[model samples]
Target: MKTLALLSAAALTTTLLATPAHAAVTQWGACLPGQGVDPRQECTTIEVPMDYSAPGGPSVTLAVSRIKTARPEVRRGVLLIIPGGPGSPGLNRPSTLVKKLPQEVLDRYDIIGFDPRGVGKSSPVSCGLAPADLSLTRLKPYPDADGGIAENAAWSRRIAEACARNGGPLIRHISTRNHARDIDRIRAALGEEKISYWGVSYGTYAGAVHATMFPATTDRVVLDSNDDPDPRKVSRQWLANYAVGVEDSFPDFGVWAAARDSDYGLGADAAAVRKTFLDLAARLDREPLAWPGAKPEQLLTGNLLRETLLNALYSTANYPMLAGLMKAALNRAELPMPNQPEEAALQNTAAHAGATMCNDIEWPNSIARHEQQVKRNRAVYPLTAGMPVNLGPCAYWPFKPAEQATRISSRGPANVLLIQNLRDPSTPYSGALKMREAFGQRARMVAVDSGGHGVYLANGNACGDRTVTDFLVTGHLPARDRNC
Candidate 1:
């Protein structure tokens, strides 16, 4: 869900184990059958006040899960796996994480994961968006062929209104601050005075806020694929960074395609590959292919090609998918089917993201302002083509932020470790630096010479993996910021 494209079917763009004492004690049970669930994961629920300010008000249940360390005697504490996406489903993260985590790290901590209040297995929210509004193009909408966003503006209003109409009180309550509070609640439920954390993407912001708000209750922290924690911009900054991120990451694809020109006739070199992609996108914009659910009238246009290009830069593994699709499009041959995720899941995540992003900070409500920004952005960054600043649901959200955005500070334990890829397509390195700056002396950064949305164990950066693992195993941080 890092790229809004990943879960933006229709443009909606889309745990832990712990046993503790008193209020934190959980009753674990078998998970209801679901995809990708690890059998070893035990599940349960925690009832939290829907509105933390009103503790006695109605409550919502969050599905929580955990995988206890078999080597309990050596267990140090609970390790919460904070997931990315304001809409990202995380109940199964513990299961997925167990496979990737080093044995020593697993032995030292009971891995925990949870579906935030409005995600899978937890209470979910949906805007009941019409099928038309749910198309993949809507997630990161492009301006009209002539650089207009009248339709994009319409989609924003429709989505924002739909969310307010269909979303219940819980949607209004799902803010990053609230998510941070929920994390604290989980910590209390686990009966831990301080919890260790490994947060990724948007999770890094939540974790940063958690460490900021409840610094006394946090132990070792690993923030991977960080977000800019500027209280003023918040999610708006995240949205804008997509343009910069794409610019930074697309070169990797260009070079890769150029090198493998024999397999895929994109171009013979980096410059040639870049020109080929730009030309193909422009050509498609002028002469679209038939696609059932693409935006700007059910046809594959240049914008969709650009969107696909942005999504493809997310991982090297996805390079072939984009390369092949481009080849097919260029040849006017059989194109691969657009990969559509389950619709209901898309709605849930879209609504979840809508609530969290809009509720995190106050967005400029003027559609004109958004259009103006988009126009300026489009001129400077052609790769993203103004999608970054395009009118989105946040511009018309139903409620104002319940509270101010959390400002991460240097006033915490020196336990936060940041690992970032210099060319992450989703969360750019420049934004990660802002996150590091926000944390100040409280965090140490390991700038890996790699590319992609995630780093540490994920990017196969041995130095990064070891640095993070060593920190988790023994509360030791590097004396100074280092490059891997």
Candidate 2:
């Protein structure tokens, strides 16, 4: 999930709970069979109107699952795990991550997961993109040397058209606002007065919107790897932040590369390692190496490295891959292409991500503006090579935003906790700071001195994890900012 939207401190408690008239009326039953993890983890289908305004209009099914508390005596209520990827499904999370939680936490709450509309196990939407069209480099935003994006623009138009034709009506309604509404509907179905939430990446944005639209319903929230909720920019801002993120995390990779010089032999010093990478990328840009069995055998330097770097930034465990690639490229030796995600899986994921980004807010359609911005970004931040600020398929997407972006206010209860990495290559610290500022006194931020995406149980330091866990367990937070 991407970062969440903003919330205001309005006394929205009155709107938090379902009305008594609606409480007993559970339109969607307990979870259905063969959906997620344990059979005990119930799954159910909820039919929601395709268009919210026309409650009785064409409807689609939302797939949901829940694992009730293992210990009824300590059970508090439901804790929703919001998945990132505007289109990522939460359906199997309860079986996966929920089981990882400490026994005490599990004992206190029923864990819930769901596939948002147009996602897995729900009503899915696709752009029907060809396998070639799903390549990481191709899907990534890249600009031509002359700062021209004619190719990108054309590709975007093609992708948009495909989605328009194949996505059906569900594609148009994939914005964050609607997703929040869907969460609320799930809350109502669960028959809970309020819900605690753990939102990661894009999930944070969904949680924020839910809090803003129905603040009182948010019992406790943990927003990890936060993104700035700037309505005007949205994902554009996120992409731009990648440049800063790379600058921050590259040093960690540099250290690792330097340390392994004897084995991989990329460089003897950190500075040399950096130079070697940049040089290799520059050379690759001019003449790509042919990688056997790869989608595009001719590996363009920028894309190959960018994709590799993106994957590496997921966690320190991946640093070896980057190191090996760097070593192979340095010696002009053959390097294997990264394994591609399954075509159907990639399409589904990309379509979901695209729908969420496209529907979250409107993107500027001016090619001239995007071209100029890309040129400036390339000149200023060569590491990212202007991909961050370049135009996306959303620029040519067929749908308009369903609603204005929600503004986050700090007016809700002080129950929000944010955990962020200082040098995250995906979500940068600067952006997390923006989220912290937006939440103001209502949230406490624990900034970890780590170099990767994700926090909490993932890339988080012990101090950071403890902070979040303490809050989830005891509802206690530091009075102010704390650096880990």
Candidate 3:
């Protein structure tokens, strides 16, 4: 799958009809059959076109799941949870959130989740990449020692070519605009006149597009960990911003590493911890160490160290894992083993993620341009090295985008709510502000003074969680932006 967590992972309208094109009667059935479906959860599938331009052509089924409110008398339609990771699984999201959300959220609406096209259980696509190529270091364009990008460029071409060869026609259709259109279809399938949405990370962009494209049918929209909808630069902007985001978040990691009283013994303080990390990374660059159980060869290089840091930075809960890895590396002992994703599942994720990113917009094809950008970014943002601006499969994407990217605007209804963490690494507060500005008067933001990516229910901030829950349940908005 994609290494970038951000690329990691809406709507109802009822008018009148019971035909094939109309809303299909959702025959709720057993969910997650082999994966232990909850008694309260029900599952079903809906058919959508491989290409919307030819709606009558080939179609793909999207898996959907729902947990209806226990109190039907006060039920307020459906609340769709939009997942992050353009490739992250979502059919089980309702199951995951059911335990985390307050009863108020679970009681007010039927919680819904689904796997998008080209993802799990939804007519999946796969590039069939070799296990070595699928590793995090190779997935992201981390340059080789001496700052050479020859291997990165070759890998980028290989990935792009593999997707083109194996991903089929559906690959080109996997994009944000089409994703928004699919949401309307899902809305119809649910037979709801209007639906509320709770979207985080990349889902925020999808939810925003759905609201923009079908404002009249949107209700109580919540966009958390926003993305910059710069029409010209969609995922490209997100990829580039990781340099800044990583630098912004590394201090938190440093503080945590310094405070630990365990075997990591990274440093006595934040500054020293950062220095230790830098020294370790430089040493790894010079002499890559073996890490048994790691795919291909178990080599721990500088790139892997940086990737581990980025992965661990997503949540405070993951700090210890990185520390453990650091300790193992420091002692030159066996490193902590990682749970490798199933080969087939990983292929599907990579195909979906790479196809969607490339199909969304054309990326710069000039390796020279990327080389310059990477060099400049590396100098300015040493925490991320040059990976943020380095070449990836997008640079050699086989197909041009199917359509122009959607331009987000404030022309939609004033039903949007933006929730953001001030120091998010993936979707930084700076980018969230751009999304907020794009919505203009259409949205009121709830800024949480947090360090992680997601906010609202997941951030453990009561003020933010209450603001979103109350809005969904009672259709109220703050007069202005509120900071928690």
Q: What's model 3's lDDT at 390? A: 89
Model 2, range 381-406, lDDT digits (tens) per residue?
Answer: 77778888888889888778868888
What TM-score would each prediction reach against the true structure?
Answer: 0.94, 0.90, 0.94
How much does candidate 3 score in TM-score? 0.94
Candidates in order have lDDT scores of 0.84, 0.76, 0.81
The clash number for model 2 is: 21
Tens-digit per-residue lDDT, 99-175, candidate 3: 87888878888999998887887777788787888787786778886677889999999999998887777778899
lDDT measured at residue 309 in model 1 versus the true structure, 0 to 100? 81
Query: Candidate 2: which stretches are off by over 4 Å?
Result: 1-40, 145-147, 296-300
The local distance difference test score of model 2 is 0.76
Highest lDDT scorer: 1
**How good is model 1 by TM-score?**
0.94
